[model samples]
Target: MWCLLPTPLCLISVFLLLQAPVAEVFLYVVYKQNSTCMDFRALSACFGPPVPREGLRGYLTEAAPANACQPIGSPPASSNSSEVFIALIRRSGCPFGVKVLHAQQAGYKAAIVHNVNAEQLVSMVADDKEIRQQIAIQSVFMGKSASKHLKRASRYEKGQFWSHLLKYSAYIVIPYVIQEFGFMINVVVCTITLVVCARWYKKGQKITVCTFKRGDKYDTCVICMAEYEDGDQLKILPCSHAWNTHTQILV
Candidate 1:
């Protein structure tokens, strides 16, 4: 069990190794208006039909009710579902599958749900198996940053600040660090533990004491001038000296 002691760095590494990563495919959506276009990154749903590798090209549309939790009436003026359209919905009020189903009923080809806050990416899951089976179109979760860019692109203006690469660097880098340097980290931790045990062992060395024999060559304690008896205890030193002192040197 001595070898089981983990250093601070090892604890951190193990914690990272045990983390559950949200599984999703990363893809970018290109929003175009007139002659200008800008690309925004999004995370694909873990459930539902996958977005095609060639990508889904559609007109971006905001749902009539915004949440898309209920039956939607029609596509807004900015969108035309006749030529494939993708619905933009907010993150609350109902299950993600319900929102996507409402968008599907309104003739949208796909749906993109944006979080209320600029936060970590989350995997989208349907509320039940029936909802999962009914979803035929692809849906994705959009971060607030990307949603903000989409709003800007709607007005045909490019965003000035895009720092999603920095915002999400920790999630990408931690897993990579654990995968690449995990063995070396274990070796370093074991080495430190061994070195600590060595120092403790050296400091905790025990001096052995035994019963004195009456007829030994030296039969007296040099410090206290006490005679040795067969049953008397003697303290043995490293220099081959034995003493039978009743107080200090005797055990």
Candidate 2:
């Protein structure tokens, strides 16, 4: 659990966590003359798709037929002019895996597939194959409107919009993140302490003593050489005498 009384650092961390606010997410494109953000529907078929990354992952500088990514020998080409090279692919002519894999090898961070019908938007659902499994980039789909906008926008600089996910999404923590960290630290400390105590006890480090028993040899205490009477407290010794002088433990 978290510390009963949170330390100054922990309290400050929690306060900072709460103070940060969530930012809205959107797909955007920036050109020399203009820049705009738009909402797009998407279905990510790649493994680990939920990892928050930049919204601009899959964008290509050139507009080409979707078949360009079909060849294994030749992956899709990215323009050297663009810093963030994402592949803009069409959603037809080959398996989605082919497009994703080819673009992946081409060094694009992500790939966007434009719908075949220009008037329609489609979900990206592909089979789990070796090629598909190999891909580890962002892939999204663009509707008729978004696809055209993307093509037009590609003429300019690529998008730079990203999720503030790593920023404020941490604030969604239950209770708070810093508290959780403190709780884990406390749990580890307590566990280690318990283990150490158990080991010490198992090694017989604990001092143990009880009242004199009936089978004890002498009834008198050797401390004052006094005879033990009824209900009288006395100490037994390993030597040939009865007294408060008991076992001499070597420490």
Candidate 3:
């Protein structure tokens, strides 16, 4: 096939796509009950070496209650589901690896852990190589706000799954779109500041050195707030701010 686009342009496009902001991840839970769909956005993605890498998207299930006090590495009965399962569980009462591996052994497609101590989201990490390798499912963490809603939805209300269907989909960006927006704002502010500084420099405003004279009523340097005695040398900034030579070092 003959190439239509320029080689450099194609390369740049591929590079840009590959260089997605690493810190940001996408997580969405769609819980459907009869006719209502409750959507939740996960706080952050899990730690290193997410299994399969393509990411997880399918029906979600409660591997256990948000506060299940179970033995470490023990797989619970809730993990037995015929559907592609995304397990939602608390981040305590066991090693994160234990809960995840147990869920994986019982056929969970992914795991969403909720933080118990704090409201902010965190990336779940396993220290053991052996345990990390056993994980063959994607995983992530959610904050308190979303987890509260999720725990309620994971139950059977009045003998039926409160939510008739549970869906879990992972993403790399856009769900954490605020990070990108914040980065952009920082860049724009920096750019605008640089432009303004350059324009000010171009205008050639000169800084003047003011020598203190005897009987001068303005005896205090505004920047350092030091009393200016006779013969004190001051640098008057273009913006009308002034400081004494002794205070210039601090500036």
Best by lDDT: 1
- Candidate 3 has which clashing residue pairs, if any? 26-171
- After superposing candidate 1, which stretches have Cα over 4 Å from the reference? 1-22, 33-37, 76-82, 155-251
Reference-based TM-score, model 2: 0.42
Per-model TM-score, in order, reads 0.52, 0.42, 0.54
Give me the candidate number with maximum TM-score: 3
Q: Any residue pairs clashing in model 1, and if so which?
A: none
Instruction: Give candidate 3's total backbone clashes.
Output: 1
Output the lDDT of residue 94, model 2: 73
- Against the unseen true structure, what C-alpha lDDT does each candidate score? 0.63, 0.48, 0.56
Clashes per prediction?
Answer: 0, 8, 1
Q: What is candidate 3's TM-score against the reference?
A: 0.54
Q: Distance (Å) between predicted and true CA of 118, model 1?
A: 2.5
lDDT of 2 by residue, 129-185 (tens): 676668787665555665566566544333333211123243344445677589899
lDDT of 1: 0.63
Say what the RMSD of model 1 is: 14.5
